[model samples]
Target: MTLLRDLPLSALRALAAAARTGGLTRAAEELGVTPGAVGHQLRQLEDRLGVKLVRREGNGIVLTRIAEAALPDIDRGFDALASGLRRLRFERRADTFTIAADPSFSSLWLAPRLGNVRAALGKLDVRIVVSIALDSMLEEGIDLAISYRYSSARDLASADLFTERVIPACAPTLIRNRSDRDGVEMLDRLPLLHIDQTMGDDVYPTWANWFTAAGRKRKNIDHGPRFPLTVLAAQAAVSGMGALLASELVLRQHLDSGQLVEIARDVPALTIKRRLVWPVDGPKARRASAVAMALAAVARAEADGLRSAVS
Candidate 1:
């Protein structure tokens, strides 16, 4: 950019605000300066540019034809400059917290609870990056992360938000025909829904694990349609596709909305832990601490209500 340090930034700001507000007093209110100061800046700007910029009109002031022609560009330039400065300020400080999480968790759980977090944090800005690729948390400058698997990074701080019990879930209509008490036994007979995303990771406990936990011996545990995401798998199960082993905490909304129901509430629930992770050694780690506190508040507020809903 060409150096225009000779043009006073304060004068340009006053001119743009006056143009936008259509009056000196309103511009002064926005700029936190007096109308006389604004008028003086406008005069100085006009003198520097060697042009008449404003004229007295009745009891008010109006932009001259030359100033009117320049108003649009000046407004655009000053607005862009202010915006760039705001971004830089956010970047330098800890006002904005960047978060990363699994899409399913982000959509089903964390996104819904962000309102509470926002309320707790008050003035903090949150940027959410949803992806299954969470190993890059440190590289991405993620202040906080919600992940299905536990973190093994020695340099990162981790907190267990909550553990979810996995249960057989399906559309209520799917099991409505079988009113018998041993409906969970039918889970083996139906086409079991398997989330294919966890096939490669092997960290998330799968259908086989759930069956073992439920004390059933099914050899064909891998026989089900595959989906790339858990959210998709849960939706498919809700559509009466097949029974899916889903998280009790994650499936609360589906259970509450009657989209899906657990096959056996008393049976042993498969347990899975969700965690919050962030680098231990970052300048913005303090903000991460604040976020963690907010998350804890959210968890405390929801834990009893969620667990009691079906316990």
Candidate 2:
């Protein structure tokens, strides 16, 4: 049997219209076509279906038995299609906002604070599109994007959301005695969980970079189980699999809950700036600006709290 999608939609519409209006002339008037076009469409429909759908009865037309049986379902399908299109139009209105972010940022940071965003926005519908690819922001309908790179797109407005410090952290049990050895020496001896550096930029820090930043150099910095995402490396650190060079912002909850502890405090930390980007002008620009302000406020408060805890 042929799929519904394989059937010609125009022919189906012609059949439905001809049956509804009870004549080729009236169907053509409804469809804005000549009566000859309507008749041709009906013939095409019949040929495709391999069945007679209508018959000439004097000056008017009569639906065949099969056509009468199928007309009601076809009419209902068209009604449903119209309703779906209406819903899409309603959702595309300015009241709804879309934010795109990488998976690590979305899950570890932004997802937790979405409630505060909702409370600030009141009735607006907020949508999140999780992705590492910032290029999607250029597509229509995406109102905002949170990413590590500062986009140079002329049509976009961008600002720093926060600069997160990367510190060495591990499960509390991983370090038995802190005072016996040098901090850099101790960290060098521990298994270090590595995040796959797929960003193809120096923005993402590695164990080798961390060691260098700490005023020391170590060999075999690449040894360890590798994870594609920061959150997974963090979990590995929590499980005492190894020490993780983690973003202080993403690891805030884990540190607070005692799942992980900051190590090598005397060493320099790596900083990565997270940016918020949105269209400079659009139907949703005003609302996107409102959301950007709200997000920055929440991020600042959280950063302050993190600093206080560390202090």
Candidate 3:
């Protein structure tokens, strides 16, 4: 309860340590200082306060009633100060931002474009967690949630990123090297890599959907090496494991590189729009807005590229 505004932080730290450890020697060892230095600090503090903070006891220092009562508050102040310093260091290091997205979008879409975003927003740390269930942006610590949905919940804000269109694609080798093979015939030689979402009991775009859209149904749509994510299925196709139903967003690079070639032009799958959702308030909302702007720019460019390709 004494005024000690002009006291040095080091002296305050030393007093806090001696009080906690019950002796100057132990406190000095813990603080990597000599016992005499700690003792000097305690004496200086007592002189400043005009009180006897420590009393001589058998082989140890005993705190006076005033020191005992005040030490806990002093300790708490120092702890709070240390915590604030740590937080300041983290904030100075970089602003942290986290996005919640589906695995397919993360691996196939956002992951590829993250470098551009990083370049645009320097000294910003970004993380992505994949899950199908919609997360409350405030509750789950998400800055943004990208989902294939019509609208965000009433409590959340939203932006429509872009729509998804798919095409049947296979390794270029399959078509270039096996020119004699037809769609049905090629199935026997090359695997029909099916994305096995049955385990999770989720409805996902399948080879059957593509075939049916083309007015041709392959009875063996369910056959081949199965993967949980569409991105994995696309990779399998890239590796020549089999053909996959590739979303336009996921396979843009492969199609451009001639790594994956469209098997049929007639089968255009149903389009699905990706929406960005975020909470109305907090640090996360600000981060989400910045990220959404960058992402929207990317989506626009992609759409333009697709338009050129289609034209």
Best by lDDT: 2
Q: Candidate 1 residues 1-311, lDDT tens each?
A: 24385668999888878877878998999999999999999999887789998877766678889988988888888788878987776575466677877667777778787887775555777778764345676665677877766767787787888777877888887775544324567775777888765411356778877777677788677988888777888889888898887677667789899898888555677777777777787877766777777886688768788679979
Expressed as tens digits, the lDDT of each residue in 1-311 for candidate 2 is 45676767888888988888889999999999999999998898888779999999998898999999998889999999988987786567557677887667888778888887776566777778764455556553678888777777788887879988988888988877775122666786888898875442236777888888777877788888998878888888999998899788778889999999888877778988888888888777767777888899998998799789999
The order by descending lDDT is 2, 1, 3
lDDT for 264 (candidate 2): 81
lDDT of candidate 2 vs native? 0.81
Clashes in model 3: which pairs?
A: none
Q: Could you estimate the TM-score for every candidate? A: 0.62, 0.65, 0.57
Index of the highest-TM-score prediction: 2
How well is each residue in 1-311 modelled by candidate 3, as lDDT tens digits? 23655646777788778777878899999899999999898888788778988887888888899988988888888889888987785565347677777687787778889876775455668778865345445555666778764334566788888877766778877774434333444543556887665321244567676666666656566777877777777888898887787567778788899888877553345566677777767755666677787888898998899799999
Query: Residue pairs in steric clash, candidate 1?
Result: 166-270
Candidate 1, residue 290: how far the Cα is off, in Å: 1.1
Alpha carbon lDDT of residue 128, candidate 3? 82
Of candidate 3, the 10-residue stretch with the lowest lDDT total is: 176-185
- lDDT, candidate 1, equals 0.76
